[model samples]
Target: MEFSIKDIIEAGEGYHIEFKEFLDKSFVEEVCAFANSGGGRVILGVADNGTIKGTHTDNSFRSRVQDSLRQLQLYLDIEIRVQDNLIIVEVPEGSDKPYACSRGFFIRNGANSQKLTRNEIIDFFQKEGRIRFEELRNEKAVFDNDFDERAFENFLNMAGVSRSIDRMSLLRNLDCINDEGKLTNAGVLFFAKDIDFLMNHAIVVCVLYKGTEKVHILDKKDFKENIVENIDNAILFVKRHTNVQYKIEGVQREEIPDIPDVALREAIINAVCHRDYFDRSSNVLIEVFDDRVQISNPGGLPSGLRPSEFGRKSVTRNPLIASLLHRINYIEKVGTGISRIIQAVDENKKSSVEFEYNSGFSVIFRKLDRTSEADLGESSEKTKGKNAEIILEAIRDNPTVTREELCQITGLSIQGVEWNLRKLKAEGKIKRIGPAKGGHWEVIDYSC
Candidate 1:
């Protein structure tokens, strides 16, 4: 926060900096605004017009300022410093927000401190993490009309909860439903079918672009299923469009993706778990270009998370949603997602990951070049990628994806999908791991 006094005065006031000729009751209001929003500095001896007007920094003046600030009951403490005739007052962002002086609740909007209306104050509280959306009950979501039995059952199995428990007791234990028989937002998001109808912005839209820019679209899919399903399908969309090279190591075969799927999956899960469901204007997005893959979600880092401690600390905006994902093993633990993504990318040594935040959070993965692809494979020359590769990617995306589901994913007929499945099995590229009814496909091949 150290800065040149001359430069600051010349630059005038901004969002985080204000200038005042002297300390007054309104000066306390400015401090209140700064504490309510981002912490800022107010120069006591400088006028609003940037003229240097010398003011006293004696004990009497400091006592007046301290008394006025105490009226706000602010957790933010102000620090005073003297630079010649100028007095610098440093206001820290409040640990307990909604700070206000006798005037009213004021927030710094650009260079000015504006008063907050009742609705604005409520919105501010929500933004400040006071009112959480996940824990709120959605009275509109009827249990019978919106619930997905299969999805709920799958969740129970994945979470290791027994079906012997009554439905109400199970849901209550999971904190999905209230005693009033209404579903929580977390419950609806975790098990509701066609969730977009209830929560329109609760979806993930994936797109594959032709080049580095967003000019041309090659493929697109919208996932409006349950939150967990949205994460899974969004990941599948990525693998479906990326490049992979097959390699041989003794008796074992490996399929190395151009970008690490582990990192990508972690990013996707992080987006869904941390996205601001309060925002109806934007949905989670997965965009793939020729050079990199990007995943974005509405709302940046939460209030408690500092920019410097981003990857090192974990602060989730949606704790219940994170808990559900954690139970299903979609999230191994809280706060380790960023580190895991970094670890996966580092180990793969093909692509690198970058993160950006502010109003929105985005994770970008730089693609490995084609030369690296050739180096990892059998020969320098490229082979023509066939249906087998797409099928294998689909299998990798979801080993439990059924034949009929394969037809939808591949845009192929039943006969065509069966033929490729048989061919892949006969060639020792993939195999059915269990009985036909509950089986999954496993890849063991060196073909692209």
Candidate 2:
């Protein structure tokens, strides 16, 4: 395309335009960056100040520039032309993305060519769907020896598939096994005997701070299990640290968590499903403070996905993992998790959830302020005891009630009920008369 020098100068340098005074090694980096990201034009005869300083337009120089680009690992086809004594090189967006030269992987950021870090390159590969970690085979993963049969069976039942099918056939059909009968990464993540040993970074780290800062850690847990189990365990951890309020809805008493269950669940699932498995530096994190809860994952939104498309578009970084979750009904729909979280928060009349992203993605849910009803200096123990009372009543109603049963009866979660039970037993208010299976509860003192 022909462009007037006046017009090119008027446009200035941007994401799709770079100005260079002469041909240099940096031009290759610029070309690679443009090819990796969106296509852009490099005016070799132009100065950084937008002053036109013409370069050699000889056929030999043109041939030299073309040869230099060809030296890259991936051959990129660029358009070169001489316009009004200036060398204009047009680098198109690469079809085979993540283009790199001898220098390193480069991507255009604003008007500059920024080299990608090791983690950044892996993240870029994941976002572009170039490298699917879930599809890669784990050499140590054996189909029968290292598989968790019970977990696989549970998944099959949830997916509504019959056990009559041969185990190998079923696994192959699910794309969890390769032609060599070896398990894929997804298989290892979902049904491995020891997920932590094989994929340590797949775990979820949960922390409860005393207040807003990290000065005091009230509780901490590292859940290393199958991806599905990790999600559930993480949610349970959040429930243990947060508050619950009871409401009378006609004949039923409704229990409401400080952060809506739907929103928290969605955030947790999103974190697990979309996280960059290649990034072993950090696992999915669930941090609970006095005023907010944050769920963060290694990689942010996929490349090419605009912030405007946050909840509207569907793009799977780990298709195999997402597909398996979908089969088990863990995920209802693709690209709807964010919207569901927002809807749940709105329905609960809670503060809006904030999404912060860069190298990592974080979903922060603000806790509702319930302190207005009480005095300014009132201890939080009073509010906690109020919720604990509901658990006490549930235990009184059914001495043989299980933790799950109590959760259903009082709207308290499994971890919440467990925490309350521990506190009750420690205070000598309630005692377990027998083992877990046929345990009966005895109330020593009903007063809170």
Winner by TM-score: 2
Global local distance difference test of model 2: 0.77
Worst 10 residues of 2 by lDDT: 370-379
Model 1: residues with Cα > 4 Å off, grouped in runs? 1-126, 370-448
Report the lDDT tens digits of candidate 2 across residue range 305-405: 66787787665567567767876788887778988999999898745699998899999987654544232222378766776787788788889877766
Each prediction's whole-model lDDT (CA): 0.77, 0.77
lDDT string, candidate 1, 1-448, tens digits: 2336775565445555789887777888899888876577888888887789889878887778778778775556679888888788899878787776778887664456767653555555676555458767886799989889999989877876545556765665455776577888888898887688878798899999875557779999999999988999999999999888888999999998967877988999999989988888999999997668999999998755678989985556675677668768898877789999999999988788899999999999986544533232313223214556778998988999887677566554444566668867898999899999988888888485
Q: Ten consecutive residues with minimal summed lDDT in candidate 1? A: 375-384
Candidate 2 contains a number of clashing pairs equal to 0
- What local lDDT score does residue 34 receive in model 2, on the 0 to 100 scale? 80
- Model 1 has an lDDT value of 0.77
